[model samples]
Target chain A: MQPGEQRDEVEMLSLMLLIRRFEERASQQYQAQKIGGFCHLYIGQEAVVTGALAAVRDDDYVITAYRDHAYALARGTSADACMAELFGKETGCSRGLGGSMHFFDRKNHMYGGHAIVGAHVPLAVGMAFAIKYRGEDRVTLCFFGDGAINQGSFHEALNLAALYKLPIVFICENNLFAMGTSVKRSTSLKQIVDRAEGYDIPGEIVDGMNFREVRDKVAEIVDSIRKEAHPAFLEVRTYRYRGHSMSDPASYRTKQELEKYRLDDPITRLRAQLTREGKLTNEQFDMLDKRAKETVLAAVKFAEKSPEMPVEQVYDYVYFNGAKE
Target chain B: MREITYRQALNEALAEELERDPNVFLMGEEVAEYHGAYKVSQGLLERFGPRRIIDTPISENGFAGLGIGAAMVGLRPIIEFMTFSLSLVAFDQVVNNAPNMFLMSGGQFNVPITFRGPNGPAHQLAATHSHATENFYASVPGLKVCAPATPSDAKGLLKTAVRDDNPVLVLEAELLYSSKGMVEPPDEELLIPLGKADVKREGTDVSIICYAQTVPLALKVAAQLEEENISAEIVDLRSIKPLDEQTVFDSVAKTHRVVIVEQDHPFCGVGAEICYRIQKNIFDALDAQILRVSQEDVPMPYNERLEKAVLPNADKLVTAVKQVCYA
Candidate 1:
């Protein structure tokens, strides 16, 4: 591997590790009643975001559904800010008003972690439209799950984006389940990409489990999307190691299936490949893993030190224009 | 400079905006080939092509949410609901998503989009179709709400709404589409500033605050009262959300007695807000209690007679003004 590529992989692996450890701690906190409201983890789908985000530009916009903590962190949100948001702290990303489902950092151009299913898709399209209208060269990466593809907003937005040739990339994280029902029961089209034909946009299916492949394919499409100034759809086929959220027992899938996915764990494979190619030393990998865990621990410490959100702050940040006091 | 119907003024405003800004586009159900349900978008598809002036599906939530999203990235989208009642289907998208996006994202993006459509009850439209939600929509903080009464206001307000950095809701009156008046020929682009009320007619006896369709009814009542030597000032509340309380207060201060006329039911309506503001700002100026002339508090009936019986008419304003004057 090239030295620069090796360095990039290390950085990506570090992010994946930080996200995994952060979520594991978050799940524990939820069970212990330390964290409140709903909590969805990206323990399994870390590679999909780590790889996809690596291919995009910082100026480019990104939007996603409620299952969005991963994308927010990958897009440049601090570990402490995300943890504080999950803990509902005053210093959180949304100032603790939005909780886990609505993590947002405008400074990073990361549109909030939306709660509505398939709702943020059109906003992504609109963002792209704005780019095209202004005659700017920027592509938007909108991440959504298989569940959102069935929503009317998804279809209408896709059709409109195609019709207008908006610069948007629709990334479908097809983890095969919508809350509890499998994709088969929820949709007639086995392949989510099939819906793209109806909108006249190009579509592709990718192995979301492989980080390098996901990154290579995303970079290929995202680069062209910037040059072409048109939108494309990507269906990243992957699995979720955890349940839908903290409250779910994950009764939909079996332990064997989970174990089968473990064989292709993006983090494990990437780390092993780096070690085998002599791109990384065992001691170096161990230190990097330890540092990622320490970072997560430090974030937890920071979140724990923060004060709880005041009840009255609930009504704040409702309007950015400051129309309401 | 050119005399045109309210519908024509709106069409002129849209066509003019499209020509000026490549970023501004119009989209909604039947906004293109079908020429809009109200035909306000007629001939736009031919002028701007299918891409810029497009038609969408009947999914209100979907398209409304799309407009919000589209606005965030940089495009200015103009969405149309057939009427205010149909806007309820996308209430979550408008009230929750679009308005909250900027603040929630900590100013990451601003939705420069407009949701325009006919608002309030029309002849024979029942509960399912007839609704005046100016008050409901105005309550939301991030959005700007405007109800244009004249052909000039329609053209001016729509031009301003298209360029606003925040989301705007333009509520058009279905009955006033055919009303004719000369529009200020899309001369220099002017905003006509939001929350400002226009005194359509000046008087000293009593003040009648109305907007949209009711503005004309109040004007007619004022003209009829002229024969009786009772000068009634008609205040047109062009923008309801950022209400022009000063204009209403100034008129109320002079008139002493005041009456509010609205097509919507008075219960928790825009009329109530006008009454509340009048009492709050000019309590000493009033000679008596403020009277509200509004549609009867019930779903609009389809029968022409029943519809006439409930909706605010010149007769109702005449009676309401006399009551306020006598009190």
Candidate 2:
């Protein structure tokens, strides 16, 4: 491997490890009742977000659906703040107002972790429209599940984005399941990327389990979007090891199916690739794993120590800059 | 001052705001090439060019969410809904996304968007087309609901709605769009601040409070009441959400009898809130029981006579006023 490729592999590996450790810790917290509301973990699907975000620029915007812990962390939000948000503490990224489903960091240009199924797609399109309207070269990266592709909002947003020739990259994390129902049952078109052709936009399907492939393809796509000022769609085929949410027992899927996806574990595969290439020693891999655990534990401690939002302030923030009165 | 139609006043407001602020743009179905569904945005496309005056697909959810997204990044978007009844299709975008973004994001984002369109019953457009959406939008915490009753108020209030930082819903009456009234020049800084009620015509015997299309009904009823020697007061509630409670209470304190006339149904409507507030604050000041004249609680019929019967009119307001005044 080239020196530059080695560096990219290491960075991608670290992000995947961090997201895996953080999600595992969050799962434990959810079981312990420390975290409430819908907690959707991004355990097996870490490569999709970590790799796609690798192509994002500092000024560009990122928005996604409820499975957002990894997205927020990858966008440079501190793990402590993200964990605190899960704990509903005042120091959280959303100041405890938005729990697991909604995490917003404007400084990082991470628009939000929107909860409504397919709602934020148009919002991302709007942001891209603003960028193009103002003659800026920035692009917005919008992520949603395969289920969202069937929504009218998804189609409408894609049509608008393509018609206006706005700069945007729509990444569909096709996890094969929309909550408990498989994509085949929910969507008539099995392949999510195929639907993009209806809107006259370029579409591609990527191996979401491979971080290197995701990183390279997304980087190329984002660069093209910036140059051409047009929209594109990517269908990243991935899976989730855990259930849809904290309360879900995942009764519909078989344990054998879960075990099969475990074989294609993104982090494990990346670690092996680095080790075989002689770019990372076992000792270094162990240290990285150890550090990831430590970081997650520290984030837990910070969230536990953080104060709850005051009950009286619940009414605040309904409007910004005050309502016209 | 000059006389202008309510449609012209709205067109002038959009034109003036588009010229004043480079960040301001208009987007909706038929707003550009079609000159707006109601021609309220007439001639804007020729003046502002295509970039500023954009026509969107008939996807309310998409365009409404896009408008909110634009507002987040320092652009003020005026989203027209064709008619507010069509806004229901994009209700999630307006109620869930636009309003909650500011609070849910902890004030990092403020959605400065104005959703304007003709609202309430007009002619015999039937059930799906006509809707009194002011009460529905006013019930939301983050949205500001405004319904202008006249050409002047339409011009002034729309300017404020476009300039305000919060998400404002300007529900213009379809029936009043062609009605002419005196308005200040387009270039004149004629912004009527929101949350201030206008006493269209003042008297002492009874107070007939209304907004939007009902304001005209109240005015007509007041004239008839004057002929009957019943001094009736007409109050046009320009702003519905940040309702001018002080102005309403002051008028009620003097008149001692209140009758709320609204195009919306009576159950939990804007008038219901007004009735509650007045009775709660100054219940002892009332000499007669508070009453309300509202559209019948049924889907609007297609027939003209049935539609007219379902809607509130001057004759209904006159009867409501007489009942309150004991005349």
Candidate 3:
């Protein structure tokens, strides 16, 4: 699209690698007892948010469920901030009150990392409602897992979004399972995108593993959503390499299925695409991989060194202004 | 000053705020076109237009959370519940999302939204419809809760809530919609700060601490107790939370005996919290065990007679004040 288009693609490859290495490091930190609470890794599904963020403008809002390190990273939040959030330090995003599950970057227009299955869907709709109310051209991209579609809140949000003809997209990252229960056992739809028909919204299924495919499809959907100012549904059918949380043993699925999906791993595919384009040499790829690991290593170190929020100031943010004052 | 009903006061406050700030808008079931379920928002749609005075489907959770989301970026939304009993469907938004947004985000966002409309009992609306609602939001950290017992208070607290940089819930009594009192004109900008209580009828013997629907009840009880030479001070806690304990404490100090009256149930009610605070703060000032005249702990019955039986009555408050006075 630009004279430096290949460089941008190579830069995207670096971002995906950074997220992969960052998530791998976070897992180690969780196991080592540095990061507490439920750590849901966005290990395999980095391409979804990576490409989705590429399609949206900086002012357009992005909100997602708890599996959100990649989303935060892709939205330009520092590795230091994201890592420090998991470590529960004052320098972390959310000032360490929300650990692992809630990563909020207000400046970046990333609403938050909401933990509830379908709670944030309505919130995203409200943001989109504001955009339309103000007659702005911004579109909101709301991400949730397959399980969130079953929630009454999700259905209500879908109806309101379509009815109001708000500029918003509901991106369903169908990673097959909601914690332990598979999508088929929970959601009624055979194809998750078909659920949009019930709300009279445009729906599509995209290959989430390929970076270019996710970016192109999401960009197309976003373009129309912005133009017509209508809501749309996008089913990103990807898989997670790890269990739902760190606690999940993943006994719900077998090794063969995992290996089959890993064969078309998102990062590997993107890396190969760059390789086939003759843009990325083996040495350059190794250097980029090493750079991601070093950045993650430094992020871990920064997290380890950051101080925890003091107990005395715990009441600081309870209200906008002090009631007693 | 002009005399107006509680419903009129609310309508004026909303109109003034909508005119004062372009960002402010009203949204809820029957809030527009229908003129509100209780007619509190009558004539707002014609004045403010559909953009500001909007109507919503009966999707409470969606709309409530939607209001919070609208507030997240920067819009002051007044989301009405028609009846706060319906708010139970959106409890997560009220208790979790709205209140917790400010705190959870490290103060990154302030949900400058107000959730209002008819709250508490109205006629024989039975158990499911009539909820005191204070129990759900009273103790919520990031939220401010206000209940106005009179027209002036209704207008003042609402305007204040609209301007306040926090999520506020204004619990209006459905029964008090038609009840009239003096409220300042729109230009007066009748703004009552939250966390303050009003002393409605000053007395010396026993304090009748109450709010919302109970403020009128306490005033009636105060009148009934006056004939028997019992001068009872009435502490109308207009703002339920960030509670105006100083006013309550001052009232209790002047009137050693106390009788807390609430339209809602007794167990773990707002009265119970007030009782705990009074004893803990001014134990020696309390000459008698602070008694409470409250609705009996049972589901509201549709039978008019049984409903009257469940609600606090004049005789119950008279007996309660006399017992404390005698002790």
Candidate 4:
């Protein structure tokens, strides 16, 4: 194995670990009532974002659905800001205006953490449109879950993206169940990639349980997208260990099914790969895990210490032209 | 100043703004090759080319959200709905995503998009096509609604909507598109700022509060009231949101009576808001119970006669004004 590949693999492994630790802490905080409002943990689906974000350029645009904390962290948003955002503190990424669902960092090119299912897909198309209009080489990485594909907006977005040949990669992370209903009940198609046949766009299915696999496939797809300014659909098959949100107990899934998926967790798969490749030692793995825990603990402290947004500034940002609400 | 149709004034406003800013673009269903369904964007394709003048499919929600996304990244997008009635399908994008983007992202993003098209009941167009959506958009906190009554205001207000940093909706009337009115040339840079009411006709007896298509209706009623010696003032609320409350209150204080005219339903319409604002602020000045001349609270009928009866017209305005004037 090349030295650089080993280094990248380690970086991705550490990132997935950080995200995992951050979410576990978030779940604890939400239970404690410190972090309120529909917190969706990105526990088992770390590699999907960790890898896709790794493949894209820094200036390339990225947008996703509400399950967005992992994407934000992977895109270089500080864990403190992400945690504070969940806590709805002024120090949060959205200045506390957007709770756990809406994380926006303009300088990082992270467009937003849009909550509405399938609504932001067209926004991604428009971002790609703007890039094409400006004659730029930027490609947009749009992420959503299995639930969003049923929306008409998603199909419309895909049609427009294909029509204009916009540089965008529609990444669908099909983590088994969309809230309660599984794909067997909701989606009619046998495979999610088949949906792309209507638009005549190229589609691929990737195993999202391994960081290396996701990173390599996305890098290939993004390279073609950047050069040709065409669109591609990628369905990443992964699983979520936790419930849909803090409130959901996930009663639909049996204990055996949950346990079965947990064994194939993305974090474990990446760690095993690194260890097998002789790139990670036992002490180093333990050290990395401790460091991730420490980082998350520090973030929680930061979020706890951060002040709440003042009431006087409630009307702020209602309009960019300074008109009162 | 030359007399031009409201459609031509809007066309000129779009042309001028597109010429001024390279980032500005127009996108809608028939805006490009079709030259706009109502021909409001006629000849724009030849001038601006297909790059800036884009034509989308019949996907209002998709394209509306696309415009908001483009606006989020510094592009000024003028999204045209063939009619405001069709914009109901793109309600989430219009009322939620576009307006709330600025605030939701903690001010990290600004959606400088304008959703413009012919709005309100016109001719014999049935219920689905005829929607006075001023109240719907004006009620949104981040959206600024413009109802230009004349060609000059159409051009000026549209140019301002394009130039403004916020999301502005220029609500034009399909009937008024063909009507001719004086409009200053583009070289004059006519920009009527939002939240300023234009007193269409000044009188001391009664203030006829109105906007958009109702502005013309109120003016005609004022002319009819002139023959009866019941002088009526016309206050055209050009901007619905961030409404010209100062001008409305001043007009109410001076006239001591108000007859509001709106193309929308009576309940919770712009006229209803105006009534509440007037009575809440200038209650003592009111000589009578503030009257409203609004469209009947029912779906528009397809028949021409029934449509006219359902809409706010000179007759409704005259009657409301007479009651306010005690004549």
What are the lDDT scores of the predictions, listed in order? 0.84, 0.90, 0.89, 0.90
Task: Give the DockQ (C-alpha) for candidate 2.
Answer: 0.60
What TM-score should be assigned to candidate 3? 0.98
Badly placed stretches (over 4 Å) of model 2 are A1-7, A322-325
lDDT of 4 at B239: 89
Instruction: Kindly report the fnat of each predicted structure, to 2 decimals.
Output: 0.58, 0.75, 0.71, 0.73
Alpha-carbon TM-score of each model against the true structure: 0.88, 0.98, 0.98, 0.98
lDDT of 4 by residue, A1-325 (tens): 1211233777778888999999999999998999877889889899899888878777889999999999889888999999999999999999889989999998788988999989999999999899999999988999999999999989989999999889889999999888999988999999998888889889999999878788889889988877789999999999888899988999998999878878998888888888998989989889989999999999999999999889888687787755422
Q: What i-RMS does each candidate reach, in Å?
A: 3.6, 3.1, 3.0, 3.0
Q: Rank by DockQ, highest first.
A: 4, 3, 2, 1
Poorest lDDT segment (10 consecutive residues) of candidate 1 chain A: A316-325
Calculate DockQ per candidate and list them: 0.43, 0.60, 0.61, 0.61
lDDT of 1 by residue, B1-327 (tens): 778999998998899889998878898899999999999999999999987887887878767887887777567889999887999988888998878876665445668889999999887887788898888888887888999998899988998888887889999989999999976756756457778899999999999999998998888888999999899999999999789999999998888999999877778888898888888877999898898988898888888889888888888788888888883
Instruction: Give candidate 3's whole-model lDDT.
Output: 0.89
For model 3, the stretches where C-alpha displacement exceeds 4 angstroms are A1-7, A322-325
Q: Judged by lDDT relative to the true structure, which candidate is superior, 2 or 4?
A: 2
- lDDT head-to-head 1 vs 3, winner: 3
Q: What 10-residue stretch in candidate 4 chain A is worst by lDDT?
A: A1-10
Q: Candidate 2, residue A91: CA error in Å?
A: 0.3
Model 1 spans with C-alpha error above 4 angstroms:
A1-7, A28-36, A87-91, A95-97, A134-137, A197-202, A223-231, A251-264, A301-325, B15-22, B29-52, B55-60, B125-128, B182-189, B279-289
